[model samples]
Target: MPYHIDLFAVFILLGVVQAIFLSFFFLSRENRKNDVNFFQGLMLLSMAACILEIFLMYTGYIVDCLFLVDFSEPFALAIGPSFYLMIRSLIHGSVSRKMQLVHYIFPVVYFFLLIPFLIQSNDFKYNSWVYAYHPNLPFRDVSVGYDPRWLWVTDHHTLMSLVSIGIYFLFGLVEVIRAFKEKRESFFAPVHSVLKKLRSGILHMTSATVIIFVVKYLNIDDTGDHLFAAYISFTIYLTSFNVISHSGFFRQVALSEPQKYKSSGVTADAQKELLDKLAMLMTRDKPFLQSGFSLPELAGKLNTTVHVLSQVINDGLGKSFFEMVAEYRVEEAKRLLKEQPHVKVEEIAEQVGYNSKSSFNTAFKKISGKTPSEFRSA
Candidate 1:
């Protein structure tokens, strides 16, 4: 092993480690289980690729093992798709069966194209550009060969990923805005933390993609001197991983849930104002989102107490506070379902602050005389 780590290689190695750490750290949430299996698999695959690259960079930098240098390029190609899949999962809440097939699309396309140059050139093992290398003063002195021809296929890999990140970023932004807008129907009305995190991460990854290419194309390759540009790109990757996977990032998960406020018998205009305020409280302060939401707790939120809120619902809304709250929640859910038919029922229930599907279903049926699905379909 050599004592000198190529400043450039060291920089890239650090990026890989940081990405792996964040990936494992964020992807561990038990709640993200939708066909999350694909994303989970992609993360693991990307993790392995990072680990191998880190190992190769470390060995070549320290131990002078040249084989590692060349082996990691193929793995780099694999990273592109893993990122694409992660974006897909975050935005769609699951991967498409079609896109899963789409994952293999590029690697397969490149294998044949790259094979030609590999055999034509013996670089399999020297300067590592077209081949393997010893060290130079500037960097690891390795060149993975940017043959313009390589870009023909590799470019597709880059382009598709940029597109994936772009699409999810938009999807996530719309959902978040819908979640917060005081409107009757948010794009992701009753938007949840998963939607928020997914969106934020999508934005981060898109930036990362932009930075990496900007540096590569701008020739910021630096002979490995100031690798800050590349390091920042990888750190973004780390941030994105956490954004995608960490459940605690969901602020709602900690807030109390909306309770079925029991109606009080006090019918009047005064009560309608209170109901409007309740809607405002849920949207603004967000205490009603907690799974622990209780009539008493919420009344406390507006300084009125459970009794007054109950009176308002029963008298003004012609229902008990419990019924009114549930009604509000169900209606909120109903609106989202009507617009985003693509969202799952369970997710919609969660968004409106319901703890389970059965409760949402039972209440929805009681109010609308149909299941949420049936109402949506109608």
Candidate 2:
């Protein structure tokens, strides 16, 4: 109640608002019900709650209302695991339920450890807030003489969080590096682009964590300028949201469905029949020539599930749906380039199922190793 709203408080308050908005925004997406969305939303919610508590403390509201002091730990403990889980989901595509439970163990244990403080009497809480945690008290003195229980909960929580996040960041870095090293050249360029963004995201998060750790280690966190941490956190969330929004996660396409493939046994004979039918469909019917053609539509025409078709494309044909489509479109574009040398590249692109000239150029270059105009000339 005694604190005034300064510039630092205003910025951190804005970060808190943004984090909260992003959390619900991701959570509300019906199509994105997977580890990626769930973990990212959980991470945002955790960060929002922690930042809100910091904002409250910075505004001196925590001092006025003693109960808030006991609420921050649960959210704080959740940050490390949520962050790790989010990255894991992005890299691995999905996380097992057992692994999810394993990540949550620390936060759950820490939550129960705070039970004693949560049940404290109002008078005791008030006295503790006034005498032990008064804003006027020096930061150094606040933890030095406190009840070990309080010290253990607060100090250990901060230390454990740094360690946990740091360890996960290192693990995520290894996963990103491995992903790059193991990447196949034949993957769809669009999917490859998304993977590159994911790699950058992993590095960005690791760098942010390092900065936060450095600030904490240098005791910059003690200067009451919690704005530094809030700004860094906001940057991370903003970058993550942009990447996720554009990465096709929000689409109806199944990115993280656990049961992507069903157990319908397609025998060797069935597979060859399906392959022949697929060849006829592509060569004769030319479904890929249609604008906005999708896997579901093609699967329906073939009288098969999307999963079965996807497996046939990925395992049987050794190509993704995007790759297959792009290959056909680019080959058609090349034929047009040879036949109608006077036609514009954009016109050819539209004729060959590409909506944008840029996309056509990218796909053409990726497939043929030359731009559309270059292909035309050569």
Backbone clash tally for model 1? 31
The lDDT of each candidate is: 0.54, 0.70
Q: Summarize candidate 2's per-residue lDDT along 271-362 as a digit string, tens digits.
A: 55556567757876778888799999888666566877787777678899989999998888899999999999989989988889999999
> Who wins the lDDT comparison?
2
Query: How well does candidate 1 score on lDDT at residue 328?
Result: 71
**Candidate 2 has what TM-score?**
0.58
Segments in model 2 whose C-alpha atoms lie over 4 Å from true places: 29-32, 122-155, 184-191, 220-225, 240-378
What TM-score against the true fold does each predicted structure earn? 0.44, 0.58
| Deviation (Å) of 211 in candidate 2 | 2.6
Ten residues in sequence with the least summed lDDT for candidate 2: 139-148
